[model samples]
Target: MKVLIIEDEKELSKSIVEYLSEENYLCEVASTHKEAMKKIGIFNYDCILLDITLPDGNGLKLLEELTNENKQDGVIIISAKNSIDDKIKGLQLGADDYLTKPFHLSELTARIFSLIRRKQFNNANKIKQDELEIDLLAKTVVVNSNPVALTKKEFDLLIYFIGNKNRVLSKSTLAEHLSGDFADMLDNHDFVYAHVKNLKKKLSEAGCEPYLKTVYGTGYKWKG
Candidate 1:
């Protein structure tokens, strides 16, 4: 999974990035609202941890920008502002969830997982498509009732593909999804092909169907 942490507090953002990275999520941090805007304008994430109060802008206005762009990226407000009005405005503008500061990272992680599931997998802990089964919480994949071993990056790639099934993903987008915004700093996306190749091999060896498809010169897609 991919997440963007938008907060001015260095310690909080650092802690979030560390915890979520340990949980197999690619995370990017934006200390200011302008930085957050730049990242969101360029890349899409599975979830965004937005702080309502920023040094440069209001997070609610960011929500409005997201709504205006019709972006489907899931949003969760992480703010110290506990007023009902702020929560209402955030939700009214389109935040999936809100967590007050001084909150538990575990709880925040749970909410993020829930939001991603609700947006991508229909709120099901286990996603099934034909002979393939994925337990999102367990971070496991089974094909034809057989467990498939995948590296962390490989597993993340699989989920990214499945969540965006049938959509043609470009190499750059895949790179960003797998490597966070650092993808922009890379010169080539050979790592993307490597990960996809490994994931495909593991799935095929596990008696899985040919769900991963390469788009010639473009990228890859998951087709049911």
Candidate 2:
């Protein structure tokens, strides 16, 4: 999944990125509120880790912007402040969860997973569509009661498609979702095509339905 980390603490942000990267999350960061706002305006993220404190402004304001825009991106407030009021305000504003600083990386990861599942996967660890089955926690995919081996990127592509099912996803959007900030530096989104092609081939070979559809000059859609 894609994530935006709006944190000013450099070391903490670095550590969080490193840990979440190992979990296969596409993460991008913004230390200030303006930077965070710009990124959120340009692309959608599956989850956002916002700190209560920023160099320019309060993170809660960012939450307000998101609410005002009616964006449904899942948000989790990660702040050094442990005040009950802060947590309450965050939840009141629109945060899905709150994590106090100095928390365990494993705990943060678990919370991120939980929030993503609840928001995107109907709060189920296992997702089943026809003969295809996906275990979010186990990170496995099965088709027609048989296992389907997919590379990490292919698996990510599958879930991304399913999470946003029935929506037309542009190649640039897929590129950003898969590569995060690095997508801007990449010359082209050929990788998006390559990965989606491989995923389609693998799923088709495994007897899965043709849920993936090409929209001509547009992009792809999961026609579920």
Candidate 3:
């Protein structure tokens, strides 16, 4: 999953990124409201950890912008402000959850997983489609009751495709999803082709129908 940490506290942001990265989440950090706005405008994240106070602007304003844009990214406000009004305001603005400062990273990780599951998979830990079964918590995929081993990047790619099934996903978008903050450093998206090819081969060998389709001049789509 991809996460955006909109925090001015450099040390806290670093710690969160390190911890979440260890948990298999790709993280990006934005220290100022301007930087956050720029990143949000360009990329879509699975979850956003927002701080109410920023150096350039208020985090609440950012929430308002997201609402106005009708963005579906799940947001969790990680603010020092623990007042009821602040929490209410953040929720009213569209934050899915609120976490006060000095909280446990494990708890934060759990909240992020819960929010993503609720938003993407209807709060289900396992997602089934035809003969394919995906265990979200275990991060495993099975076909015809047989396990299909996949690389971490391949697994992430499969989940992303399944989540946005039938939608035409461009190579740039896929690369961004996979590369996260380092997406800009990518010279080309040829790695996407390799991963998709390998994933398709694995699934097919595991007795799964081909659901991933190439869109000719466009990109690729999950036909499921």
Candidate 4:
């Protein structure tokens, strides 16, 4: 999953990004409210870790704006403010969960997983599409009841496709989802084609129904 970390504390933000990246999440950091606004205005993320106090503006206002825009992205407030009013206000403004600072990283990770499961996957750990099953927490996939050995990129690609089933995904969008916002700095998207090809071949060889579809003149889609 992709995540945006909006925190003014540079060290904390960096640590969070590093930890989340180790957990197989695409992470980006925004040190100030302006940067956070720019990121939310441009790219999409599966979840956002928002800090209520920023250098420029209060993160609560941004949360309210997100609510007005009807953004489906999951949001978690990571702020030092532990007042009941702040918690109630954030929840009222559509924040999924609130976590005070000086907490365990594992707890934060678990919360993020819970939020994603609740918002995107109907609170299910295993996602099933016909004969294919994906265990989001375990980061594993089974085709026809057999485990499919996939590279990290291949697994991420498969998860992305399944999460957005039946929706046409352009190459660029897929690349961004897999590589994060920095994907645009890449010279080419040949890596995307390579990973997609490998994923499709593996699924087919495993006797799984072919679900990855390439849209002519566009990109690819996962169809049930």
What are the per-residue Cα lDDT tens digits for candidate 4 across 71-156?
A: 88899999999899999999999999999998899999999999988877788999998888989988998988899999888988
**What Cα-based lDDT does every candidate model obtain?**
0.92, 0.94, 0.94, 0.90
When 1 and 4 are scored with TM-score, the better candidate is: 1
Those runs of model 3 whose alpha carbons end farther than 4 Å from true positions after fitting are: none
Instruction: Estimate TM-scores for all models.
Output: 0.98, 0.97, 0.98, 0.97
C-alpha lDDT (0 to 100) for residue 35 of candidate 2:
98
Residues 1-224 of candidate 2 have per-residue lDDT tens digits of 98899999999999999999999998899999999999999889999999999989999988998999999999999998999999999999999999998899999999999999999888999999999999999899999889999999999999999999999999999998888888899999999999999999999999999999999899999988
Score candidate 2 by lDDT: 0.94
The regions of model 1 sitting more than 4 angstroms off are: none
Model 4 earns a TM-score of 0.97
Q: How big is the positional error of residue 38 in model 1, measured in Å on the Cα after superposition?
A: 0.6
Worst 10 residues of 1 by lDDT: 176-185
User: How large an RMSD does model 2 have?
Assistant: 0.9
Give the poorly placed runs of model 4, Cα more than 4 Å off: none
* Candidate 4 backbone overlaps, count: 0
